[model samples]
Target chain A: MERERICFTLNNSPVEIHCHPGERLVDVLREQLDLTGTKEGCGQGECGACTVLLDGRAVNSCLVLIGQVAERSVLTIEGLAAGGKLDPLQTAFVTEGAVQCGYCTPGMIISAKALLMEKQNPTEAEIKEAIAGNLCRCTGYIKIIKAVQTAASARLEG
Target chain B: MQDQVVGSSPVKVDAKDKATGATKYPGDLRVPGMLYGKLLYSPSAHAKIIGIGLADAWQVPGVRAVLTANDVPGHNGHGVIIPHQPVMARDLVRSVNDVLVAVAAETMAAAEEALRKVKIELVELPAVFDATAAMAEGAPLVHPEGNILSHHKIRRGDMAEGWARAAAVVENTYRTQMVDHAFLQTEAALAEIDDGGILVLHVATQYPHWDRKELSRALGMPEDMIRVVGGSVGGAFGGREDMSLQVQAALLAMHTGRPVKIVCTREESFHAHSKRHAMVMHYRTGATGEGRLTAVEATIIGDTGAYASWGTNVLRKAAVHATGPYIVPNVKVDAYAVYTNNPFAGAMRGFGAAQPAVAYEGQMDEVARVLGLHPFAVRWQNAMTEGCITATGQVLESGVGLRATMEKAGSLVGWDVSKING
Candidate 1:
C-alpha cells in the first residue's frame, strides 16, 4: 500500500506525517506522533480509553480513521498540564484518591474537562453523567465523583 | 500528616502516562516490516474438520504466513486451569469460536481478505446450550470426559433439624446476567522471533508472568523462549488473564520472520473474551419468629460455558459464601459448574460474592416481611461481626466490617428509613 501525507495539530503543535491509508488515528498518534497518552481500551468506541479532544469534543481516537483527522486539532491528556504543573482536575483526582488502576483516569479527565468546558458549575449528577461512559472498574465512582466536585469548587472559589 | 501514602491515597503511578496518551498499549505497537494478522473462526458450534483449504489464501497478494493446528510446536492446548482448549482447533471444533487458521499480511485489509479466501469443510454435530440440559442423560458431550465440569458442596449442620427448629422460613430464587469486562481496550499483541531465536511478545494482560508460562506451554516453546511484557492495559477486570492473540501472533511472527500485530475488533473482543458466569441460585432460609437466624440452604447452578476458566473456583466460593454474612449455625450449600455452547465464563469483579449479595439481601428482606420485623432490625439481629465463622468453616480473623458497614448505612439512612423494606 502507498503512504499518504497526513497533517494534524496534536496537543498544541502542528505535525505532518506520512502513513498507510489504513492506519488508525490512535496508532498514528502513538507511533508516529509519539503521543502515547491516549490509551486504547477497546478498538471499538465502547471504552473511552483512547478518548481525546477532537476539535474540542471528547471522541475516541481509536474509532476515528487517521484520514478522518487530517488537518484537525487533537488534544490528549498530555496537553492538560501547563509548565510542569498538574491540571486542577488531575490534582483533585490525585488528592482525592480518585484514580485506581489509572487506566480510566486519562479518559475520565478528558471527559470531565469536556463537561466543565460546557458547564462552569455542573451539579454532582452532571459530573456522573459525563464520566459514566468512561468506566473505572476499581474505584466504583465514589471518589471520582468527589474529585470532580472538589475541582468544581476549587474553580469556583478561585 | 506525617508523609503518609498507602491508605492516604497517592495518584495512580500510571495515571499521568495513561492520561497524557504516553502509555504504549499493546495496540499502539508498530514494528518495521511488521504484518497484520487475523484469525479464521469456525462457523459451526460443534464440528469435525474434514478438510482445510489455505491455497487460495496463500496466493493472495501481501500474505506472508498462514498457520493451522499443525503449526503449534508445544502442548497444542491452553486453559488457565485445565488444558481443554486448543490454541488452534485440531480434529474437532468444540465451540463456535474455535480458531481454524491464522493469516498474517502486510496490511489488516489484506490479512482480513486473505482470511476470507480460506475455506474450511466441517461436519456439524449436535450442541448443548444449557447446563442442566447438558447434564441429563443422552446430552451432547461437549468434552470427551463429560458435560459436567465440577461440583462443590458445603455442609455445616443438619438442614432438616434447623428448619424444624425455626418459626419463620423464606425460600426464593435469584439470577444474575452475563456481564463482560467491557474494558475500553480490546485484545491486541505484537510479537516476533528475535534475531537470537527467542520470541518477544508484547501484550496487555492482568497476569503477565502467568501468560509467560501459559503461552510457552501452548506454543510448544521453552518458557525462556517467550518473554511477555505487560502493556498499558486500558482495563482488565480479570478478562485478560486468559490467552487471546499472543500465541497466534507469536507463531505467525516466528514462521514469517517479521513482526506480527493482531488486534481484535470490538465484536471480536466480545466474542473471544470470557464473561461473568450467568448464575441461578435457590435459597431456603429459616429464622426465629423474632427475626433471629436459624439455618440456611442454597443450591447454585453456574453456566461455565465451553472451557473451564475459573468456573470451578467461582462455584466453590459462591457455595461457601452463599449464606453471606449472616450468622447461621446450620447451613448446607451445593454449587455446580456445567458446560454449555455459550461464551466462556470466568472471574469478574465481586468474584462470586456479587451473586449472593442480591439474592441473600432479597431473602433477608423477605424474612423480615414474614416475621413483621423491620429489615434492618432483622439483619442487625443476625449480621456477622468480627470472629464470626463463615459457612465454609473459615473464621474471619480480621477485616470483618459487615456489622460496621450495616451500622453506618443505617445511621446515614436514619432509624425510620431502616425499618422500611424495599
Candidate 2:
C-alpha cells in the first residue's frame, strides 16, 4: 500500500502528511497530525462530534476523507480561540453550566459559533435548531439553551 | 448539615478535555507496533461450531494472527453475576453476535479483509426469542441452567385483606421500549503486553476497577498482571459496563505479542452492547373513595437475554419502585428476571425505575379518574414525604422530592384545577 502525499493547513499551521486515500480526515488529523481537539463521536456523521469548519463552514470531519481535503484549510475546536483569550461561546458555556459530561461541548460550541457568525441575535427556536443535532443527555438542554442565549447577547454587545 | 455532591450539579471533571476534544478515547489511542483486530461474528443465532478453516484468512499479506476459543488459554468466559457466557464460543454459539474467530493485522482494512475470508461451519439449533415462551415448560434452554435467571418478591402486608377494604380498584399493564445508550463514542480498546509480559488494557469503560477484576478472572491471569485504564469516554449511559470488545482484543494482543486495537463499528456496537431491558409490568392498586391509597400490588417481568449482566438487580429495582412516588400502606410485589435469545439487556440510565415510574404514574392517573379527583390533587395527597417508607421496606432517611417535583411540574405544565373544571 502506498501512502499518498497530502498537504493542508490545520488551525493556521501548514502541514504535509502521507496517508491512504481512504483514511478519514478525523483519523489523519488525530493520529498523523496529532490534532486531537476534533473528536469523532460517531464514525458516521449522525452525531456532530467531529464538526470542523472547512473553509468557514461546519462539516463532519469523520465523513470527510483526507484526500478530499487536499490544499484545503480546516479549523477545529483548537482554533476557536485567537491568541490567549477564550472564545465568548466557550466562556458562556463554562459560566452558564451548559456543559455536563462535556462530550457534546466542542461540537455544540462549533455549532453555536456557526450560528453566531451568521446571526448575532438568534431566537430561542433558532438556537434550538442550531444545536438540535448535538444531543446532551445530562443537562436536559435548559442550561445549554441559556448558554447560547448568553453568547448571542455578548456577541451583540461587542 | 452539609449537602452532598451527589445532589448538586457540578461540572464533570472530564468536561474540559471532552469539550476541547483533548481527551484521548480508546479509538483515538495509538500504540507502538500496534495491530488492528477484527472478529468474525456468527451469523446464526444458535449453532454448533463444526470446524473453523483459517487458512485463507492467514494467507492475507498483513494478517498477524488468528485466534479462536482454542486460543483463550484461560477460563474462556466472562459474566457479570453468573458465569454463563464464553469469551469466544467454545463448541456452541448461543447468540448471533458470537465471535467464532478473531484476526489481527497491520492495517484495519487488511484485518477486515481477513475477517471476510475466515470460514466457519455451524449447525443451527432451535432458539427462544421471547421471555414468556422461554419460561414455559420444555422451552429450549438458552443456558444450561434453564431460562429462569432470578426471581425476587417483596410482600409487605396482606393483599387480600387490603383489597377487600378498598372502595375503588385500578388494574393496568404498561410496556417500555428497548432503548440503547447510543453514546457518541463506540466501544474501543487498545491492549498490549508490556516488556514484563503484563497485558495493560486502555479501554473506554465506566467501571475501570471492575474491568480489571473481570478481565483478570476471564483471562485466567493474575489481577496484578493487568492494568485497566479508563480512556476519554464519549458517553456510557450504562452501555459500556459489559465486556464488549475487551477480552478478545486482550487475548489477541497477548498471543501476537504486539499491541492490538479493536474498535467496534456502529452496527456491531448496537449488537454487542447491552441495551435497556424491554419490560412488561402489571400493576393493581386499590384506593379509598376519597382518592387516598389503600394498597398496591405489582408483577414485573424482565428479559435478561443471554447473560445475567444486571437483569436481576434491574428486576429488584423495578419491584422497589413499582409503587412509584405514592404512599401505600400495604404492598406486594413480585419481580422476575427471565432469559431469552434476544440481545442482552442490562443497566441503563434511570436503572429499572423508569419503566415502573411510567406505569405507576399511569395507574395513579387511572385511580384519580375513577374517583373524579384532580390528578395533581390525588398525587399531592399521596406523594411520599421525607419520613415515608418505600415499597422495599427501606425508610427515606433523607430528602424525598416527589411532592416538590410534582408541584413544580404541575406549575410548569399549567396543571391548574381551574383548567380541569373548564
When only the first chain is scored, the TM-scores of the models are 0.93, 0.91
* Number of the top DockQ candidate: 2
lDDT of 2 at B254: 85
For each candidate, the DockQ is: 0.50, 0.53
Task: Name the regions of candidate 1 deviating beyond 4 angstroms.
Answer: A1-8, A16-34, A40-44, A62-72, A78-86, A118-121, A139-142, A145-158, B1-7, B397-399, B416-422
Off by over 4 Å in 2: A1-5, A20-22, A83-85, A137-140, B1-13, B416-422
> Residue A158, candidate 1: how far off, in angstroms?
6.3
The sequence of per-residue lDDT tens digits that candidate 1 reaches over residues B61-123 is 999998999999888887788977778898998775578899999878899999899889899
lDDT (Cα, tens digit) per residue for candidate 2, span B283-305: 99999887888889888888878
TM-score of each: 0.90, 0.92
Each candidate's number of clashing pairs is: 15, 0
RMSD of each: 3.2, 3.0
